[model samples]
Target chain A: MSPFILICVFVVAFLLGYRIISNVPSLLHTPLMSGMNALSGVIVLGALTATTLAGSPLSVLLGAVGVALAITNVFGGFDVTHKMLRMIEGKNRQKRARPELLDA
Target chain B: MDATAYNSIAGILTLAVLYGLHLMSSVKTAVRGNLVCALAMSAGIMMTMYKDHAFASPVLCTAIAVGMVFGLFLSNTVKMIQMPQLVAFLHGLGGGTAAFVGLVILLDIGVANAFERVSACLALAAGMITIAGSFVAAGKLHQLLPQKPLILPGHGILANAILAVMGAAFVMHAFALDTLALFAVFLLFTAGLAFGIVFTMRVGGADMPITISLLNSLGGTSSAIAGFAVGDPLLIAIGGIIGSSGFMLTRIMCRAMNRKLVSILLGESSVALGAQDPAASVSSAPIAPKPADGENKAASWLTCAGKVIIVPGYGMALAQAQHRIKQLADMLKGRGASVSYAIHPVAGRMPGHMNVLLAEASVEYEQLLEMDAANPLFAEADLVLVVGANDVVNPAAMEAKDTPIYGMPILRVDEAKRVIICNYDDKPGYAGVENSLYRRDGVILIQGDAASVLERLIAML
Candidate 1:
C-alpha cells in the first residue's frame, strides 16, 4: 500500500470509530475499552508476517513471542469483556423474566 | 492471494469489525457484538495464515495455543474489582507485541525508506512506553505498588532529557546511519522505557483513570504504526479504530474530572491549591459527632423516606459492599420508598467501574442514574444514603474555591433533605479536598467498614 493510501485508510477508520464509539454510553465504557483493546491486538497479523518472513532463527523466536503476547491480549480482552457484558445482561434478563417479583 | 485480493478481503473484514462495534452501543446487543468482533478476528487470522503460509510453523502454533490458555485463565479468574489491573496488564502485552514487531522489522527486514524507518521507530517508542506505563498503572491498581505519587527531584527536566536523547536517535536512524541503527534502537527503547516509568511513577491514585486511558491510546497507536511499517491494511484500519476509541475515552475521563491532560501527565498531585483557607481543611473543620440515637434516627429516616438516592464510589469497591448496597436498595424499595443510585462520572477507579460492580451485585440498570440525571432528583429526595463514597459527593467541589476538586462536578448529595453516610473514616477523598457535606446539619455520618455498616442498617430496618 502507498503512504497516501495508508494515511487515508487510517484517517477514515479513525473518524468512523470516533463517531460510532461516541454512541456507547458511559455505562459500558469499561467494556468498550477492553473490546477496543482486543481489536488493537490485530497486530498479530504483523507478528505472523514477521515470523514467517524472518531470515534468522532469532528473528523467528522473537516473532513467535510477539504472536503469543498479541494472542493473549486479544483473547483475554475479549473474554473479560464478554464476562462483564453477560453479568449486566444476565441481570436484565432475570429482571425481565421476573417483573412481578420485583414489583412485590 | 495477490495484493489486490488480500486488500479486498481486509476491507471486508474491517467493515465487519466496525459493524460489530456499532452493535456495542446498546446493552441489549453488546454480547453479540463482542462475539461478532471475535469471529471477524478469527477470520482475519485465518486469512493471514493462508496468505503467509504460517500454518507450516509448529512453533508458532504451539505458542498460540499456550497464549490462548493463559488468556482464558486470566479472564476466568479476575474479579470485577480487579478489572482495571487486568485491563492494564493486557494493554502492556499488546504494546509489547507491537514493540517486538517494530524491533524485528528494524533489525532484520530493514526499513525501505525514511518514512518506514520513522514509523518503525515511532512504533517501538510508543509501544515501549505503553508497556512500561501500563504495568506501573496495573501495579498501583493491584496494590502491588504504593498508590501515592512518587516525584523525583527535577522529574520534569529528567523526562525531557530522555525525550531529547530519543529524538536524536530517531533522527540518526531516519537519516540512514545504518552503522548506528542498533545503537539508535537501544537508545530509543531504553529512553522510552525510562520516560514511561518516570511519567507514571508520579501519577497518584486519583489520576489513574487518565493514566490508564492515555496508556491505552498509546498501545493502540503503537500497533497502528507497526501496521504502517508492515504495510498491513487491516492492521492499520482496526488499529486506528482502537486508537481513536482510547483517545475518546481519555478525553471523557479528563472532562469528567475537569482536569487538563497536560497537568495530569505532569504528575501534579492534589496538593497544589490555587489559594485556600486552612480552616476549610478536613482536619481543621469542626466535626459534630453523631448522637447516641443516630442508628434509630437513621432507621426512622429510611422508613419515612418517600424518595431516596444512593451514591457509591471507589471506597464502596474497596469495602466490597455492592451486594449489601443492592440489598439496602431492595429493602428500601420493599418499604415502598422509591430508591435510585446516583453515579458520578469519575466515581470509581475507571470510567463506568461502579456500574459494573453494581451490575455484578444485580443492581437493575434502570435504577442507576448518571450524575446529571441524578442531581435534579436529589432535591425531591427525602433521604440520601452514601455508601463508601466521598469525593464524588463532596460539596467542596462546587462551594470551595481553589481546592484540588474545585470546579469539578459532584452528585449534589447535600441537596437532599437528609443524608446518611457510611464511610471508612471522616477523611477527605482521593483528591484530598475536605467534604463540605459532612459539616451539614442534615447529614448523619456513620464511619465504619461499609459492608458491616450496611449489614447493620439492614438488620435495624
Candidate 2:
C-alpha cells in the first residue's frame, strides 16, 4: 500500500477500533486482549508474502520464523481465550445443572 | 487467483463472521464465540497461501508446522490460573513476528522509497520493545521475576540518548547509506529491547496488568506497521482491531485504578517517595490459627458478628480457597449472620478477576458486591474477613498522602468493626506497602493456606 493510503487506513482503523472497543466491559478485558492478540497474528500474511518473494536463504529463514511466531500468536491466543471463557461458561452451566448449589 | 483479490475476499469474510462472534463472546458464551473467531482467523491465514504459486519451500512449511504444534500444545495444556502468562507469551510472539518480518523485508527487497524504510524501522523498534516488555511483565506476574519496580538512576536521560541514536539511524537510512542503515537497525533493536525492559522493570506489580494491556496494543500496532511495509491491507485491519482493543482496555483499567495513563507511563509511582519508613515494615507473627487455643478467640468473634464482608485478592487465587470461602459464607449465613463479599475492581491480576474465581466456586451472584456498594456498608459491618488481600485494603492509601496509592480508591474494609486476615505470608501486597489493617487492634491473622484455614474456620463455626 502507498504511504498516503496506509495513513488513511490507520486513521479510519483507529477511530473504528476506539468506538467498538469502548463498548466492551472491563470484566472481559483478558478475553478481549487475547482475542485481539490472535487477530494481530495477521502479520503471518506479511511474513508469507515476504517468504514468497524472498531472494536468499537468510530472507527465507527470517520469513519462516516470522510466520511461525505470528501464527503461534494467532492459534495459541485464540484457543487459550476459548479455554478461559469455557471455564467461565461451564461454571454457569454447572450451576444450572444443579440448582441446589445456588440455594446451598 | 491474484493475491490481492484473495486477501480482500478473505479479509472481508473474516470480519463479517468475527464481528458477530465477538458480540456473542460478551453477550452469550465466550467459549463458542472464541472458537468461531479462531476458525475465522484460521480461514484468513489459509488465504495467505497462494494456491497456484505454491509455497514450495519445505523449510518454511516445516517451520510453520512446528509453530502450529507448539501453539496447540500450549493452548491445550495451560491451566486457567496461568492465563496471564499465556496471554503475555503469545503477545510477545506477535511482536517477535513483526520484527522478523521487518528484517526479512529490508534484506530481500531494498526499500524503494523513504516510506518503506521508515515504516520498516518503526515496525522493528516497536516489535522488539514489545517482545521484551511482555516477557518481563509475564515473568513478574508469574513470580519468576522480582515484583518491585526496576527504576534505574538517570533513566530519563538514558531514554533520550536512545532516542537520539534512533534519529541518527533514520538519517543514515534516509540517505541510502546501506552499511550505516543496517548498523542503525541493529542499534535500534538493542536499544528498543533495553528500553522496554528498563521501563517495565521499574513499574510495580499493581501496574503490571496495565502494562500488559499496553504491550499487547504495541504488538498489534507494530504488526500493522510491518504489514504496511509489506503492502498488505488485511494485516493492517486486523492489527488495528488488536491495537485499539488493547488501548481501550488499558484506559478502562486505568479508570478502575483511579490513575492516569500519563502517570503510569511516566515511571514507577513509588520512586518519588524515596525510602519507606523502616519501623512500619516489621512483620508480626500471625495472630490466630497457629495454636489450638487461638481458634476459640477467632471463632467467638465470628459467632458474634452480625454482618461480615469478605475481601479477596490474588492470594486467594494462589491458595485455591474460593470454594472453602464459599462454604464458610454459607455456614455464617446459616447462623443468621449476614454475609457478603466486597470486590475491588483491581483485586486480582485482571478486572473482575475475583468475581470469576468466586463464581467458579459456586458463590451466589447476589452476595457479591462492587466497590461502591461495599464501601458504604463497611461502616455498618460487624467484621471484615480479608482473604489473601493486602494492597486494596491498605489504610495507608487513604491516610498516607505521600504514598503512590494515596489518591487511589480502595475497598475501605478498615472502616469495619474488626478484621481477620488469612494469607500465606505477611509480605504485603503488590504495591509493596505494609497493610496497617493487619496491625490494628481486634484484628485476627490466620497464617496458613486459605483453603485449609477456611476449612478449619468452617468446622469451628
DockQ of predictions, in order shown: 0.80, 0.58
Docking quality tier of candidate 1? high
DockQ of model 2, rounded to 2 decimals: 0.58
Spell out the clash pairs found in candidate 1: none
Candidate 2 Cα errors over 4 Å, as ranges: A99-104, B2-7, B17-27, B51-55, B271-297, B300-308, B330-340, B359-370, B373-383, B424-428, B439-443
In order of appearance, the predictions have TM-scores of: 0.95, 0.88
Model 1 C-alpha lDDT per residue in residues B1-461, reported as the tens digit of each score: 99999999999998999899999999999999999999899899889989999888998898788778888888899999999898888889888889899889988988787678888899899889999999988998887887767778898889889889989989877764568888999988998898889988887655777888888888888888998998999998988888888888889888878888788676666554432422132224334545637777888889888899999987689889999999988998998989889988777778889999999999888788988889999998999999878877888888888777888888888888899998776877767777878879998888767788788888889
Q: Specify the poorest-scoring 10-residue window by lDDT in model 1 chain B.
A: B274-283
Q: Residue A68: error of model 1 in Å?
A: 0.7
User: CA lDDT of A15 in candidate 1?
Assistant: 94
Compare the candidates by TM-score and give the number of the best one: 1
The lowest-lDDT stretch of 10 consecutive residues in candidate 2 chain B is B277-286
Alpha-carbon lDDT, every model? 0.85, 0.75
Off by over 4 Å in 1: A99-104, B271-292
